[model samples]
Target: MNEGYRKDIIRYLSVLNNLGGCHIDTINGFLQKPSYIGASPPVSLFPSSDGKSIGDALYQLSIVLERMTDNEFDDTTFYHSKQLKSPLGPEEVRRLNEISLSAKVTQDYMNTIGRVFQSYQLFELLSSLEEQHITLISKALTSIFPMDQSITNDISTSKQKNYQGIIEKIKQLFSRTKIELFLHLREEIEESQKNPHKSSISQATILDTLDIKSSEYYLASALRQLLSTDENSLTTLVNELRKIQPLQITQLSLLPFKDFYQILDLQANFIQMANTYQFFKEDSNSQFNISTASEIKMPSTPEIKIVDQPPDKAIYKRNVKPAPSVSFQGDSKDLDGNYYVSVALLRCNDFSEEPTFLNGASKPTKITNGKIVTFKKLKVMVTSHQQGETLFCFRFDLRRYSSDPETNPNDFEIVSSVHSSPISILSHSTQLKSTAIADLPKVTEVFPLSGPSTGGTRICLLGSNFADTPAIRLKFGNVEIQPEFFSGGTLVCNAPEHPPGTVQIKVSNCQNQWSVTSATFTFEDTNTINPSSNISSDALSNILPESVFGLDFSKTFDTNFIIKGLETASSTLPSSNGAHRNYSKQY
Candidate 1:
């Protein structure tokens, strides 16, 4: 009989001992941690006391053991493991301790009406209570994890129910918890829109209070939906997460945007371990049936058509201005409501890549004549499109979009796509435009042709067909600056500091249009010039090779000094054969 009892004890203890790892630790710590109210025990209902009966004694013993686990008896002179102070009084710890032992053996045994059983039954009772304790902490606390108004209502309306009914109730509570978490996250996201820098509640606090382990997929889907609606929420959440010391976001600050996706992906893998504890099951063989929860319905793919296709050649000035935009029209009747519409810019070469398809649950869906037109798809835009709307305009944000194909074949593949026509998109500076040379602006002359290399020299540039706009710039060699003031035929600008040499001057409208002047401006070094010293013509002809090769010595002197020590050197140095004063070397 003792052996049989030991087997039962071992079996129950095995189940009890299995409660380890992050899930159980998280739940236990969550229960043990101080609530917003105060630092209090998990429950007052199971307080230790001298029992009225044998069953009552068992309950008291359970409470005593639990308090031992909580280290309630530990003090300056004693530890619970080595020497424990009894709850009844401050007494030295022993198996034969006076107060607690007398209460358990004499008072409880005499008061009991039933037959006194073997000591094995007591061990069995203790194990059973422990199992109940685990269950109480893990399951019963689900409805009151965070202890909000909703939980108060649940407790007020609570009643006794059957086993199956109780299971259903727990499941419902889990669903409600998920909903509350979603609502809280939505509120944070909305608040972030008003003040992006506002710190949100910590995710650790949320994870502890919300019981996220049981509702992983639900919470994940909620987060995914939230991201789909407002992408800025992710940025706000990430910033808030960076505040957590354990996440080690100090190192993550240097990580690229793609690394954030990888971090999220790793966190998402925890879904596989979600709801792993099976407290309701009788044994390992017992099947736990979980009814499928309702999910967010993904709307059917609408037939997308380009209503107002962008020009064949669109100019994107990077971040200076808004990116290229195209107006698209989707079937309003077919689409039930507004949904996310993603736009891609695919090159002409992408259409001829190996055929690929968007892998769906049932079958692969092809795009654009089944030629895998979105192989090298650059996802430039994502905008919300509504039904019955005349047109949905998507402005491409190509700041992160890449046109290059993956060097690694194992890279992430796109599963859903829509792309624009084969269009050549060029940057504002690189875009080619045909303009007649005769119609272009011409720089005829520049007043005060020379200025000190110390800069701050006001000069007037005389030109023809000069753009009468503030956008016009006077470019001296590689250095460019906006005019202080400009008109149709003339503009004035302060000379930017340069080396003591002549640089070709030009008037640029910044639209890839330049009015080149045959003349140049000389930045004479006043400090280096000596009117009394008469240098021979042969000595003045010996120019530094750095000036000829355009070697920049700006770092040492640090003033955009492209050429140095050429205060009196002429623009062209005479050759050894004395051919022409126009001696120049084209490097």
Candidate 2:
């Protein structure tokens, strides 16, 4: 009986795996196979047939299965069923009988099957059973699993918080321009809804009449409210309206009231309407009125003062100062071909402060031809100061009027000249005298000379004194040759046209007395000799170097012997005349 109980439990588990979710077809396919076997218990070594004892154990199994299915068990139901004198109680017997009589369990047996299904992960089993059945099995498993109410509430709160955050961000973006308009439009809409005839029909009403969505409808409605009465505020509102129109007007037919003139007319109408509804007014003529609620004063206009001055006759006066000549070193071009003059004024000993005209003094500096002369005003006060015997240094950039006199009405001409003030040589006695010698021009060590034997050898004469110096004269032994000076301390020259021997290449600057000499260079004439002719006989005494004629010349010492042998061999050979005679005779 114990073995049978285990077998029954195994069969119940197997059946649950098949019957769960929408896995009916897959379960049927697996069960129809020959190899497929239903769950059976291991053979029980000890068997009991005592109905009361067996029924007690069966009753327990029944209660366990019921608990697995419903996820809860009733102790009262179990107790009442256990009193019956049967092999199994009413519920337990019925479940066992169903398993025994059928090859497969039907949907009616689902309650018992659910008990076993709940014991194991039915979803995992169903996943392997069929692909299509996964979602159904997942739903079933979710339904069976116990949920935490607190966790669910927390998730819901988190979602609500995220939604609120998104809403706040959207409101912030809209509030920049749209919100104010929306509020005004909403007020108008509310008023329109309350009293249709009393409220002025806005262009926003046309947008609403087109049955636009809330997002699209609000922008136009809001903009119309912003420009309702104030025409001066229309400029700012028009710019804001441009941004909204493109975003909101996906369909062109929605906003029928979009002409500029129509908008202006609407604004004018709103102004007129607002002016007509003014409830309070100031009574300037009356001292007091009892019926008047309150009298408000309008803001007065600000007064502007204007002064008139008689035009003076044109008088030419010169307040000119002599300027020294200056040489500008760089590219300078006139913007309009007008003569520009720049002068560098020297600072003098008496010049305490930089030159500046006194307050209200007009010193019109004019340039006639290419020279600048200042025009004297009636009450001009000019003062000169010297600092340690030098006046303040000033650079005056003046433009000439004669060059393009028609264009310049100021009657000032820029002197096409620049000036430098006298160099203020301080008194020698007061100036700090340095005992140390002034920085002498640096003389660099000459680089080692290098070049070909064909006379012109370029040698880099490296040193500081070489800079700005015209020619660098290099001494090759006693011969002095001036090298072409190039930028980077390089000197190119013929190497004194020396013989094919080692010569000392020396370098000296044209400006300096000191000379730099290089170590002797053993010059070899590359075109002079055949290199093979120079090979010593001692080096090739035994094994002869191969001759161009492929002969062992070292071994063949006797030339006369070779000549005699060639002569004897020629005697044995047919002569050219003899061969010609034989050919003639044969013919």
The best candidate by lDDT is 1
What TM-score does model 2 achieve against the real structure? Answer: 0.17
In candidate 2, stretches whose alpha carbon ends up further than 4 angstroms from where it belongs are 1-393, 398-412, 415-587
- Backbone Cα, N, C clashes tallied per candidate: 0, 31
* lDDT (Cα, tens digit) per residue for candidate 1, span 1-587: 12122222222222322333432222221111112334455431112343343233343332222222112222211221122112323343332233223222222221120111111222222222222222222232332222343433232112212222333333443445534454566566567667968875454544455555654323332232323233344343333332322112111211111123332332232222222432223562243222111111122333332222332343332221212222223344533332223342322321222112111111112223211111122222211111111112222211111232234322222222323323333434334355335445688766556767866665556667775433356788877776643346655566777889998888765345576454488999989867588655445334211222333222211122222335535312221211121111100
The superposed Cα distance between candidate 2 and the true structure at residue 247, in angstroms, equals 31
* Prediction RMSDs, each to the true structure: 31.8, 47.9
Question: How many clashing pairs does model 2 include?
Answer: 31
Residue 260 CA error for candidate 1 (Å)?
A: 68
Q: State the displacement of the C-alpha of residue 104, model 2, in Å, after optimal TM-score superposition.
A: 99
